[model samples]
Target chain A: MPERRPKIIGFCCEKHGLDCVTLAARSERQYDASVRLIRVPCTGRVDGMHILQALEDGADVVFVLGCLEKNCYYDTGSIEGRKRVEYVKGMLAETGIEPERVEMFNASSSMAWKFHDIVSSMKDVAERLGPIRPKGGGSE
Target chain B: MIVAERKPLDEIAKMIAPYEKVAVIGCRSCVAICLAGGEKEVNMLVSAMRLKNRKDGRKQSLDGFVLERQCEKEWVKEVEEKILDSDIVLSMSCSLGTQTIGDMYPHKIIVPGLNTAIFGVPEEQGVWSEKCLGCGDCIIDTTGGICPIARCAKSMLNGPCGGSSDGHCEVNTDIECAWYAIHERLKLQNRLELMEYVRPPKNWSTSHSGGRRIIVKEDAKLTPHQKRGREVLE
Candidate 1:
């Protein structure tokens, strides 16, 4: 069998999340191409369904990137996002999926180094977990 | 309103495993307000199920629909065709909605997605405490508007039982004793005399102990035409 690249999906809060990523790009900081970033109005807007949908779409891991807790552009938006991520983690665990497969991170727009580290950390975890085995009796 | 929580995902997945096509239905009334069964919840459940199918290599299709109110016959009628079209239905609404769907379509398999918790009000953003038992006999007036039937651990009509101390129920120190709350409330209102009145045993027949119950209002009875959907409002 050959090795397969783990698919990683990131739900980024536009206010700070996307800005930080742009900063990382300008600084010429390299990150894995396997990571896909989706920008939303605020991290709070990233519903639990969106996270689950991303996973169902074959992404090995999903992460929610948001503004610092007390500094969210939408007030408690990032905090709400954190709660949502935590909720999905519990659900995944109940379904026999690794809770670590989903994660939430906080950072400001100027923190390009932090954003890079976040992506690297998520990618590493996804690689360690490997592909999810289909439930029931079947071979994928 | 009814408050409920979604059942574990694995349990729901197993229930719908036998079906090839499933409809995930949600209610916009009580369950929706509680964030249990609603349009958002329906979508998430469907998405999670699809992911499970993908990982398991199972060939199943899941769809979502949110009714205005699943317990009402009229609102439920709107999705009659869509539900009938699916191989099975996974209801995200409370048990009432699940049963209502089951009653309307006796032949189809109805899967309950939520565990109906209680009839209560939201004390905070995500916390809900049971406040009503639907005992069919409401005596809150004499209890200073604090219901002993629902709030009391033992449902003691005249309480603050021997187990109550420091205004907390012995069953759980974290819970405030309903009778204690009643006493304070009544005292503040200068109606402490109401508490001295000896109370008689409650009529259990008004509760679930009496078996399935129904309310009939002669004036609210539907006409034959209305029963046939002749007067269904859009």
Candidate 2:
């Protein structure tokens, strides 16, 4: 059998999360190609459904990257983002999925290393989890 | 307002497994304010169910919509087309909203995504407590506006029950004794004599035991308006 390349999704907030990614790019630091980043205005804008929908669309793992807690440009946006991630994690657990498949992270615009670490951690999780089975015979 | 919590996802998944197309309906009224069955909840449920179906290879198609209020005929009508199109409906509203949708589309299957928790308000950000029992009669005027029927463990009308201790109910230490609260409130207002009035047995006819209850506003009916329309037609 061939290896299953993991599909990962990151809901990145425009303020700090995406800025960190851009900063990493300028520093010649690269992230895994398997991770797809969808930029949003704020982490709080990423609803619980958005995370679940990504999983349904074949993402092996999904994470929300937001500004540091209490440092959100929208005051409570990152906190709201964390709440949404937690809510999705609970739902995933209830549906027999690994709750860890969905996660939340906080970082500052200057912290490219932190963003890279987040990606690497999610990549490791996705590799171990393998491709998410769609509806039929993917039994955990 | 009615408060509810989402039913476990596994239970909801099992409930809708047999359906091919499901319409997940949400309400933007009380349940919305309570954060149970509102637009966000509707979207969450739909996404979760669809993800589950995909993982299980079930091929079930789930769609979602948030109605103004599923309990109203006009609002229910807004989603009539979608409700009719789907094989089943999963309601994220309170029990009344679910029942209203079921009544509107008698031919469709209706499932509730939330369990009606209680009639209460948020004490804080995410904490909710029961407040009203809709006991058909209210004596809050004399009870210093505290509802013993809903808050007291024993629903004692005259005063605190034997179980009340240290301003707490015997049933749970976390629950403050309603009678004690009423007493304190009445004392502050200098209306302690109101407690001396003996209340009559509650009229249960207005409650669930008396069967389906209805309230009609006779004065609010538009009979005169209809009569004027008829005269204009003549």
Candidate 3:
């Protein structure tokens, strides 16, 4: 048997969230290739269904990256995103899954370091949790 | 609109655990507006149940559907095939919607995914406050267009209870005393004199206390001849 690499999914707001990630890449910073990012118009558009579906599809860890709550591009988009993340976490807890498997992070366009930190932290979580076992048997 | 809250995920999970095929149905009317049961909620719940099943090493098939108004027979009829195909139905609507499906198919297993809370209006973006009790009688005309029966702690029709303090209900500080609000509204409308006229004892027979009440609209109902004709057509 070989070591298994964790799979991670991140739902990022196109506004500040994507900007931060893009800037990090431009700065020659490298994050794990296993982390896949899905861009949306705003964090508010990321519903709880998306997060749960990610986990259900076998992603070890999932997260939403949005603009800071106080300075969201759409005023309350980040707040809404945080609320949905919290709701998903509650559902996960109820389902006997680790609530920490899903998380929400805030970022600004200029904060490349924050993007790296978010990815690193989420990657760490995925590594710790390993892959979520599929319905029948083997992990994805 | 009727307001409701989703039942805990564990409870819902346990409800359909014995069934291999389950259908999660949601209503797009009041439950949708309240963010309790709707298309999105049905999908979320299905996904959550799937994940939970996967975690527990259980294999169950779950499908999600939404009805325009689950309380209506026509809307429920549209999904009759889907309801019949499933071993159990998890209704994500108010009790009325749940009962509609149960009534339509007495032999099928129907369970509620939400706890019907109140007849309320959205106070703000995410807040819903109970505003009516469906008492079957309208008395707001004498109470400044505010129903003290629903808002007041004691449902006192005459005036504020002694426990009311500083415009808040004694039952719960968060509740605004309905009588105080009525008084303010009456004063604002320059109808303070209306308060002096004491209300007589309310007739409780018109309310739910009277036991299952029914209103027959004779004009709208089909006559015996029409019923026979419709039966022939069917």
Candidate 4:
């Protein structure tokens, strides 16, 4: 059997989070191709439902990348994002799912290395967990 | 407002296990404000349950809905068809809402998704503290707007009991002594004399301790003839 490619989804804030990813690509840094990036106005806009939905939709690992807490473009956007992520993690733990499958990371526009680290870490998680398999197959 | 907390996911899963079609309903009332049951909560719960079912290889159809107020028959009637079509309903509201659905559909199974916690006010963004006991009496006027029966662990009518120390309740150090607060509040209002006035024994008949209570307004209720006319119209 062919080695399975882990599915990873990242919700990135348009401000510093997206900037970090853009700079990483410009610097000729390569990350896992299996990872999909979603751009949002701010990390605060990401709801707990979004993270859970990603897992239900076959993403083995999901993450929220936001601006650094103290310097969020929207003042407390990243802080709010972390709270939601933590809330979802609690729910996942209660439901007997691997809490590590979901995570939150902070980044600045100039931190290309942070973007690479976040992607690499999430990719590692996805590969380790494999796919969240439904009874007969994938999600309905 | 009535505060509630969601039940454990495993318990909720077990309640709907025997049903093929399950409707997870929420209310936009007190439970919503407390972040226990609302539109977002209903969706999040359904998604989580679906994931659980999928992992366990249990095939169940789940749908989510929200009502303006679950305890009101008018809003419940709006989703009548959805209720009748489902094998069971998981109500994510307070007990009043759960009982409303249960009473509306006697034949269908209605399970409570949340434990009605308290009659409280939100102290902050995520904190809800119980402030009312629904004792069916009002005595806060003498106590500086704070109900001792609700806030105090002993519900002592006169003052703090022997358990009070340093303005805190012995039951829990985190809880402030209700009488201590009452004294401070009264002192602030310059009504410290009210503290000296002894209060009489409370009448428990007006409270839940006296069986279920009901209030009837003659003017608001329809007469027999009017009820008949409305019944015919329906």
lDDT score, candidate 3, position A65: 96
Clashing pairs in 3: none
lDDT of 3 by residue, B127-224 (tens): 99988998988899999999988998788988888998999988999889999999999999999997887988889899999999999999999999
Of candidate 2 chain B, the 10-residue stretch with the lowest lDDT total is B49-58
DockQ of 1: 0.57
Clashes of 1: 2
Positional deviation of residue B91's Cα in model 3 after best superposition, in angstroms: 0.7
Q: Which residue pairs overlap in candidate 1's backbone?
A: A134-B55, A134-B56
Q: Comparing only chain A of model 3 with the true chain A, what is the TM-score?
A: 0.93
What value of lDDT does candidate 4 attain over all alpha carbons? 0.92
DockQ of each: 0.57, 0.59, 0.66, 0.63
| Deviation in Å, model 1, residue A12 alpha carbon | 1.9
- Would you list the rank order by DockQ, best first? 3, 4, 2, 1
Model 2: which docking level applies? medium
The most accurate candidate by DockQ is: 3
Better of 1 and 3 by lDDT: 3
Better of 2 and 3 by TM-score: 3
- Candidate 2 segments exceeding 4 Å error: A1-5, A14-19, A70-76, A135-140, B221-234
Weakest 10 consecutive residues, lDDT, candidate 4 chain A? A131-140
